[model samples]
Target: MEKERRWTEKYRHLLQAFYFAFTNGYARGYTNGMIFTGKSKYLCVPGLNCYSCPGAIGACPIGSLQAILGSNTYRISLYVSGMLALFGVFFGRLVCGFLCPFGLVQDLLYKIPFPIKKKNLPAHNQLKYLRYVILAVFVILLTSLIHDVTGTGIPWFCEWICPSGTLLAGVPLMILNPEFREAIGFQFFWKMGILLVIMLGSVAYYRPFCKYLCPLGAIYGVFNPVSTYRLVIDKEKCVNCGSCQKACLMDIRTNQTPNSPDCIRCLKCVSACPTGAIDSSWNIARSKFESRLLSEEENSPNPEVTKTTLLAILTIIAGLATMVSTFKYNLDGVLVYHFSGLTSGRGVLAYMLVTLFKGIVSFFMIITGYKLFINRNDENAVHRFREQTRMILKFVIIIVIAGIASLFADLSLLSVMFNAILICPFPIIGLPLLASAASSTDKLVQGKGSAVLWWIVFVLLAVVTSYIAYISTVIILAG
Candidate 1:
């Protein structure tokens, strides 16, 4: 009996892996080559696979939906909506469970051997509703409204929040094209930050993004209750032993309810049922009952050393390294400064602002990395670090605003002082503040008043430094 159960589990994994490879088989131009531009792309896949993926042969439904909604013609396609509905009714979240490449990634991440085990946090249940909100807002309303107003609508979710898009398409495309890397700006950084957060969150939680943010998952979840392919419990056979519920990675109480929206139809519960009670049904076709019942002992969660954590850690490290490398390599030859002349002092100020903007983005990247890899489990520590990071960003913004105002005042001294001050604190003070925020005991600032006081001191220092630099420049001109 034990051996048979093991074989079943092995077969399931093999089948899932096979599907993953088959779905993404067009690996010809995967490494920065042109995406598949064939007619197959006109058809939408039932999962979150990005059309822009070089290996992807089919388009992502959510991406296609947004494109149609945001088109200049503002045309809504019944075919797209109808196809999605048909898949939802037929398979429910079976696609997410068995087909989605991104879903496979999350499952594999959870299987990583990490010593720090965490249960669902408070408010986790409430957070599940967020995916629905994302579907309604970013995927639908925002896409339609923005296109109507601007005549050029952005795929808000894909552009700003889709980690699957970032992983499958954005990163690969960027690596393939040097021109794309050079063209990256604030938008790229913002998306990477989101991807980093989602990746890290997946490490600690099972399918965190699907639970809270995936609009595609949200859509298919709505059809779970009524889908033809469903998990049904034999009420007479179920002894209410709770084994099925314990084995459910989705946190679903299978003893009470079998057809939950949260269920990915993973069949982990079906395999765990000791009474041979739980079964999968497809339009009157039910799985056969086994003569032997598996032991409950086999349901224990395994915690072994796996490559998933190492992979996640490496990804975060690579992202940070890439950002630093890009900044360093492009500093002197940043194209923005070349295209726009800095002959006037105002132009120089604008250039400085652009530099500062990049610095702010770096700050976000660093903070997100720290949160994902370092202070992930400690909620209080994460909150404190966010607050401190925001304080530093606010200081940078204030300094830039002060520099712009100084330009209008004709105070060349103030301008020099602002530049000097901006150059000073980030390394000397801001980095330390970030480090302290991650610490167990140290507080960067005691309170809001202390934070405000430090900002004022920095502003004063800028004023004084500008005055000195201004006087020196005038002296040099006279000499």
Candidate 2:
């Protein structure tokens, strides 16, 4: 029982590592050495999994980000960046300590009886700054700049550095894939050498790459002091025996500064402090009194008011998400990317205008959606509805124009059919707008006939557009 209770979050670190590895285990991809390009590719994992690892089910955020930042299509760039920030806010460098597969590999390597001269590296302080430089120049600046003839820049870190790519993706793929082996060059060997050196160094030192090379670590480290979940020192309980610092692999003075950026949040310091002065917790910087006050304030809201507030919040959030995905994924960006063959400067300008119009419509949506759901504006409801309908339709005309523009991108029957779908990013937005324009959105949602009418209108528009586009393309080709 004592052994089981020795560590407060026992086996959690190992469990997280195992969990991520299992999730990334696409066993068939190893046999084929092909990336799993499913819908999960859009869901970037928090840890630094390789972009092209055969077994990876999700895309690496950093690698995918380089492509997105370099290309004209940044449909999911903001979304991925937001995910990275969300992770940093909650866990900071705890990702490095446990979640990253590469980090786990390095940790296992360290146990091979190759201890360094000291726990930390020589000139560790100065060497640590190298990661920030790599993060800025190699990861961000080069990926955004330094383009080739294809109008996309080199992902410099992935091309020249990044041992994770080398070890996880490069080595396995070369062994498994004949076609991939044909493309091998000096660059592959160079990356392999770096990976070997880092592996050996992990045995000699503690995570040399994380300390001096990993841009992701640099990015997450910046959030350590500010992240919602982090370490704290209870000064009242502190005997200042310096046990925490002695146990720190990163050599952080945990008693003096518990939330240091260099700290990987391993929780070893918490275990080392015999006084139990060290702690791993949420909102760690806040006082007990402050937390209690926040708790009280949160509970003070009546249940009905809390429920309504939650509903309003959720409605606005849904409306905003709908607006972004509608513009970014369905209607505008797809046509802009696939149909760029025919779409020139004027088309690009039109797209920009359409995107701008989306923001206004989104604002109107959240306002009207919030008001409609709460049964507000019962006074002169008809006039308000008429005004919202006019405003919304006017903006939607630009969207219709965007869909129509897709037909010009290509004259193929497939293109025509896709244009119909783009034009109708509808049915998704349709029912909501239909309800929002009514005196009572709630009642409209309840009305089965109203929903049926909306679907009919949607179908009619798609069929009519498809016929017109196909006929026009046929006539033009004949001419």
Candidate 3:
């Protein structure tokens, strides 16, 4: 019963992690609104995953690593490596705990109501080096075959390999969109089979990929030694009964040191420690909360709003914004086409209005997103929001990159502006808007029309941004 209380919320954090991994809003600003039919946005997140998955918001690290290697011009991807460093310094293996959607998926898979127990499978601890080997092989293959000499290698991991991208984004989308299904070939089947194997393996192990083959884990582990937050073992309170080691799914010997990069911070052993010797703190500082809490709800915010609901709401807002924006921009595109051969300025003005409207919508999105973070009392919400914001910034960056590319491809100022606006929603302003609305609604119960008006504006902004983005894509492609 005690163990259940301590670890009940452990799964919740994992749930939020999954949400961030799959959901676009969490990864917003991460991918920069650049879909990967490919031009030259080489370099993705430096992890084991692939980017071609539809759910990915930011560039996949492994994909980006391969691209950097493949490109002769940029010898190394300083940006991606640096981002990983920054992430590790602050978060450590906590990334596995809070940000990885794949990790969350594995956790969910493990909880299938089937009887499962932690297995102590011992092998060469050196087996942990396999991800680096994979990284090295990818780099060698990609860099060695650089197409500039013959100009050919695109380093096709996402298309030819990558189970996460295959399972989460590729197969499902292909099923839903016939064009994608038709695009499938032998490679798709091969990848799907591999994904099936990994899915089954994950059911038996705590996290097979994370434990064995995740290059991102290896990189982040390097920084865990000095990261701001880490696990600390209080030797003074030591009974050293080996209960922690017994409980640790990672097989960590937590008595001596608890900062192993391999440790997932799942807090299982923390709960298992009979002497209360194990603790988590930032920079060796003392912690406010202990390993065991009497009530699980004490750690959560608005227990009423589950992590899934937060994820759903975020997705709804982002999708709505994109959809609404797409519709409005398409309407404007039709009007502009009608006026194109006649008076050019009218069409230009109309285009500009569409662009402006998208910008407004983006502002609302960014504002709303940020506001949610500000008021996020739940630890899971805070964790998810931070990653979401980071990814949002990245998303904006890629959109800016894409916008520049559009310029070279003869894309219009209005179109570029529209894309830029649609891509960069003002999540920072979201908190104030929500707060004001809440306060206003509470004070003026009958005058709810005003609150509704605010919501309508918010919704309209999203629509306009999506429309502008959709129309811009059409115009760019058509031209």
Residue 36, model 1: Cα distance from true site in angstroms: 0.4
Question: Which pairs of residues have clashing backbones in candidate 1?
Answer: 32-176, 413-466, 417-466
lDDT, candidate 2, 63-116, per-residue tens:
877877777555236876788898898889988887888887887787688534
Candidates sorted by TM-score, descending order? 2, 1, 3
| Model 2 spans with C-alpha error above 4 angstroms | 1-13, 73-77, 115-117, 283-479
Better of 1 and 2 by lDDT: 2
lDDT of each residue in 9-105, candidate 1, tens digit only:
5576566678767656787857546688778887898889988887888889999999988888756758789989999999999888887888888
Candidate 1 Cα outliers beyond 4 Å, as residue runs: 1-9, 148-150, 283-479
Per-residue alpha-carbon lDDT of candidate 3 for residues 1-479, written as tens digits (9 for 90 to 100): 44553764466664665556554343433333223443333434433444655445457665676666566667566877777788788878877766676777777776665565444235738766675665555544655464655554566555454677776677657755667777788888898887887677677767776776666777787777688867778789888799988887777887766888787667778788887777666523532333332244466654424432443355346535554554555445546665664335544444445444444445545564556545555445544544454554454454555445545544455554455354434332443333344334333223566547456546645654565567568768968
List the RMSD of every prediction in angstroms: 23.8, 13.1, 15.1
Ten-residue stretch with the least lDDT total in model 1: 302-311
C-alpha RMSD in Å of predicted model 1 compared with the true structure: 23.8
Q: Candidates 1 and 3: which is better by lDDT? A: 1
Cα lDDT of candidate 2 equals 0.69
